[model samples]
Target: MSRSTFVATIEPVSTCPVNCEACPVSRRDIEQPKARLMSLAVAGAVASRLRHEFGVGYAAFGNWGEPLVHPQIVELLAIFKQVGIGSLYLTSSLSARIDAAALVESALDYLDISISGVTAEVYNIGHRNGDWERVEGNMHALAKARRESASRLKIGLRWHRYRHNEQQFDAARELAEQLGFEFKPYFGHLGGIEAHEDFERGTLPQSKRRFIENSVFLEYVERAVAAHVGEGSCPQAENLIIHSDGRLLHCCALMDSHKTGIDFLALPRRVLESFKRAPNSHCGSCLAKGWSGFMHSSKVDHRSPAEVAAELAPSSAS
Candidate 1:
């Protein structure tokens, strides 16, 4: 049987200009210059592995780091195309440095941009200002790039929805249509200062709180699980993140200290081992009844004993 995994290259930068209300990384506030970009050598080595060792005919170049910030990103992508191996996916904040003509030449299979809202003010509440214009400009450029590329380069929007910008739904949908990209709204599990503060002050109001509680949220979770399971070919298995430092994590949603890092280049067995051993804390929580951790219950493997019992119990017969 042929097995496949979505190879996500996690490039981490030290700094981001945004101050969004749902920022996940604790280090977002550090008064420091941007972190170092991953060296071309490291990227090239990973590319080589994707082609040869992993037999990964499908790969992506973005995850943690802003692909736009890595000056060598385009170059690395070019090399991947040259190798004539697999599809390439690029996830970006749609910052300004994106070049339509150049990226179009990269022969990407899919391109996804993260857009939270249609207006700067709405986006600014969570992210920094320097990005607003650039993100907008990049979106336009990507639209053009998608049109020009010979290969079917899918352009799509990954919207991280928040209460402050919930009203942007219609406008964002319109923008997606105008930009020639598919729109996908995602409620982020993480929040920034403003969102946290609002929740703390009991300001989230009854309606919004109820929205979070209603079956709609469950439906979203189901969709997310179905999508992942479809892609992975395993409902119990999951997507994970292996950082540049070789840290194995249970995806960004359940990111925490319970991680394992090793030189995946030198130790492929270790990589597989970590996958078996390092199930996310959220996974454990999923086994506990009434647990409502970040890993949405609907996304959990419902075949588990707890889930089976809950579904088959007499009380649930009604």
Candidate 2:
């Protein structure tokens, strides 16, 4: 059966300057000895392959790293557009200096900005070492650029809700709405699937443990685990993640790219699908433990923090 719509997520840049606490990039779990940027030639080739071979209609830039860090980010977007990829989007922390006017002119469909809080103090709790002032300024610049150019580039503010940031949700949402951007708030989790596994095994680093205990919404984690343990296949199997080095990752959840032996430039779609379907140790463990479900949950628990705290109190006491 032909796939209706395949999505390709390519990482134009493979290093992030922002040190978000819940990101593997910040924690140094996914080691990058040196930063890498996908060359225009490689990106164009990958885009072409995704369009012609996989029938990928949608392309998203950014995975473990920030795409804005790349000097040729606009050119990278254009390459995908040139390949006839109908929909293209990218996610960014907006911590780096952004050329908002150039991005507006890039024929990009959407931009999802990852934010933890509106205020610097709370925002720093999750997005450590990130400058809230700079991110805010970038947001404004992008908004102004879109307006001035009359571009159809949709912007979204994805708020990573933590215990300390819930009160700021309304303020952030207001700001996004004021700028004609979509505001999304969801409970944040530990860094990666590896971190999630560590959390379950009570092996997380002391700092990460403290952050999870004090910041994350435990009720959401519990409910997600209850709702989806060994109940479904991995949703990530359908999507493709290409590293900046042109290697195909098993999934975005994977931390060690070296372990993924698949080469994006050479692997056939049928072989890739067969490999995706075959159970591997990492995916097997994540699936069996319900971490896959938790990560991919579509329904957000909108209960107040206090309510969730109350619900989880008994479990914590035990």
Per-residue CA lDDT of model 1 for 1-318, tens digit only, reads 367554444443423444333443333332222346656666666667656665556655554456666666677676666655567787777664767777766667788887766778777655544468878887887778667666477887877654455567777878999988887766544332222233346764443333333312333333444443322122223333445544444444332322433455666744654564555444443333222232333222313223333543222112
Off by over 4 Å in 1: 5-9, 12-15, 26-34, 82-85, 128-130, 148-151, 191-240, 245-251, 254-259, 268-276, 280-283, 286-318
Model 2 residue-pair collision total? 0
Candidate 2: lDDT over CA atoms? 0.80
Candidate 2 local Cα displacement, residue 159, angstroms: 1.0
Query: Candidate 2, residues 1-318: lDDT per residue as tens digits?
Result: 486556888888878888777777776444552578999989988999988888888988888888999999999999899888999999999988989999988868999999988889988988888998999899999989989997889898887877778788778878989999987776787766878877888987777777888887666677776677875588777677788878777777666643664878887878887766665577777887787877777544456656655765433412
**Cα RMSD for candidates in order:** 9.1, 2.5
| Candidate 1 C-alpha error for residue 114, in Å | 1.3
